[model samples]
Target: MPKIDVLAPRSAYDIECETLIIGAGACGMVAALSAHQQGEQVLVVEADAVPSGSTALSAGLIPAAGTSIQRAAGINDSAELFARDIQAKAQGENDQALVDQIATDAAEVIDWLAQAHGLPFSVVSNFDYPGHSRRRMHGLPTRSGAELIDALRARCEALEIDIICERRAFALFHEAGEVTGVAVSTPDNTQETIKCARLILACNGFGGNRELVGQHMPEIKYGLWFGHDGNKGEAILWADKIGAQVTHLGAYQGHGNVAHPHGILITWAVITEGGFQVNKDGRRFWNEAQGYSEAARAVLSQPDGEAFAIFDERIAGIARQFEDFKKAEAVGAIKSSNTLEDLAEQLGLPAQALRETHADLPLGETDGFGRTFGDVPLSAPYVGVRVTGALFHTQGGLKTDTSGRVLKTSGQAFRTLFAGGGAACGVSGSNDSGYLSGNGLLSAMVLGRNAGKA
Candidate 1:
């Protein structure tokens, strides 16, 4: 067993440790494990109970680009190739050296997740969401995010790391340009201050915090469906108090599928069949027959980045051919109507345009006798689910070098502030998310492990 010393502050106890990590998300958890394994005294303080935040809500996909595991599985991919596809998506905005380093180290990250956290992941082919030429993603079991988090939690518990839950980090302590500790408030209006030598801010996004979202990603400011209930942007506020810089505040990730009011989430396959995507006026915007990824891009590019996936009963059933889409509807995204007029009235789209465009699509494909709508086959009973822009998952945060050390604007190192996962800027330069299984998770794990070592 690794010698673990969980330096916890009980009832406002002053604490000291070699490494102190905030948030218990996948990145924080991985960083804790790596640091502890390296003989560093580690303490982790979480704002919520088990599995709270984006790591709990992730698809559990980790794209370790190239590694021994991938080699053992005979998936012949290279670090250079992975970097190329990511650069293409970014249109050359990302740092070339950083991108290459992450690509080369991706596979090792996957192996660590499995070997260290006991994540039972498998290689997924059809991993191409919108980009990437190779099958370079890893995913958990059907339960997805839960499985990965469970493994991480189990490891944390075994290590005896202090995982203080139900405590909110109200402020960070700093001294002379260095982060020192955090001030936390419990449910009962009691304040607790914990101190440490090295502090890591892994606290997640401000998506659930409406004010922060409004200030940062103003376009679809209110349309985020953070699967985790407590995605308050404490990290941004904390970083600000400590003189940390937050970059890419304007860019927020949006998904093509999510439910309404309750804001349940869904997958993009809903529009793959003959369902026509309609803009505000209910006119056809993009070919619904295209792959789910292309559809996401097309929808986001629409007027104000809004559209509804119009499909009938037939299209819904066809989309259900894939089990994930069906399960996604359980979380929201699937809408229905007994007749076309009801759907049109509900979504406030032009009824005639919808009728004219989808009138030719049959509910079932007998022998694939269609033009393959957008180069991908079409199927359906016309269905149109209204989808608005969503902060799908953050693609960037604090700027960091490939090693996960927070970097200065001058391409130098920022003192002690290391970030990984969506909390850190993605190695990918552009706004588009690659068809990556584990890109975000991999970034967090590999870089976080590196941060732990540092």
Candidate 2:
């Protein structure tokens, strides 16, 4: 018989632990750390490298509702109030209970990010991203995910948590009705079974998963929503196989942006911060600060979720006109145009109309005509990026309670399965980016920690 015969009598590489976490992104990493601290032996098995996935792509701001920070800041928030706010604001879309729990712990999670990782941040009370309440956003200086990952990675390593990367989990292990472990496809194409009394499905969403997207957000059937190619709804698929209940199937966040040559749209975390948008004809769109989410809706409602990121050498010249477009330029903010002809041509707009359109307009800034990066709009180097909207992250996912407990389809508890972060159902889908701060990371940290602790 061949060494790898038909059934090979259950592999010898099986392993066991107290908790087995899938995906090592922010959510999974935080969950592992939390579970480990609770005296549970934890293991994290990821399909990619550690600290990768959407967490790597995220801005990494952890925002919660009622915490010492929010209280001290005089933000008057509570779990009940938070839940009500999320539910009410979401228009009965996202899961009320989960949103409530996240709001409950919003600030403490950010505090943990600062205290645990030395990630510096300061509150911008009355601050607004685009959608949420005024100035409640607490911002990190860097506004990047690397800072948060550094903290999470170190903690997991110190706790001696086993992090197995490139291991593709194929099936959940179960006996009777409880999920006991998972069967994963190893890098060598071999199989291994890992065991645990508890499992955390922090593998993220189906936004990148075409099948999932098509089935749920059918409006996006032909729509483009920039998402990781690797996110194929494996978590949702796995959840389904285990008979786990899933809801909020139609909900998804819109991220409209300029499409790059890479098939990925170059939208922004906050266009209201940099500048405003203009159609291909050099016509200004909506109010810059008024409902920045209008961009998301506006972009999607168009022929394509396409728009030209209109900026001028003049606004580019204004250093403080915006944040720091120069640094952003170095980081590849968007494309530019000097003469409207070239910009229109590059972005597929009518050149004569664009020029004629601007010829009669006031040359100086008038309340908000074009991009105001800073200074006097430099000179020529005007730019624009052809962009579109993408699914970003799917809002609907596994249902959880106020404590991040995985709720069964039957409205009962699903033993050993807990979900949070993007993998969990319920998000404030008022559909505005740059509206609030730290929602993704904060939700993960707060719920992940609580679930582990519970």
What TM-score would candidate 2 get against the native? Answer: 0.78
Model 2: CA > 4 A from native:
1-13, 65-85, 124-127, 138-140, 262-270, 284-297, 300-305, 311-328, 331-384, 429-438
For all candidates in order, the CA lDDT equals 0.63, 0.61
lDDT string, candidate 2, 111-194, tens digits: 765676455665555224544543455545544555556667877787688898888676776655567777777777787887
**Least accurate stretch of 10 residues (summed lDDT) in model 1?**
1-10
Per-model TM against the reference: 0.78, 0.78
Off by over 4 Å in 1: 1-13, 67-74, 227-229, 238-245, 269-276, 279-282, 287-306, 310-324, 328-376, 380-386, 408-415, 428-439
Clashes (N, CA, C under 3 Å) per candidate: 20, 47
> Tens digit of lDDT per residue, candidate 1, span 176-238?
566666677777878667777676667765667677667765555545455455666665555
Among the numbered candidates, top lDDT falls to 1
State the local distance difference test value for candidate 2: 0.61
RMSD, one per candidate, in order = 6.5, 5.8
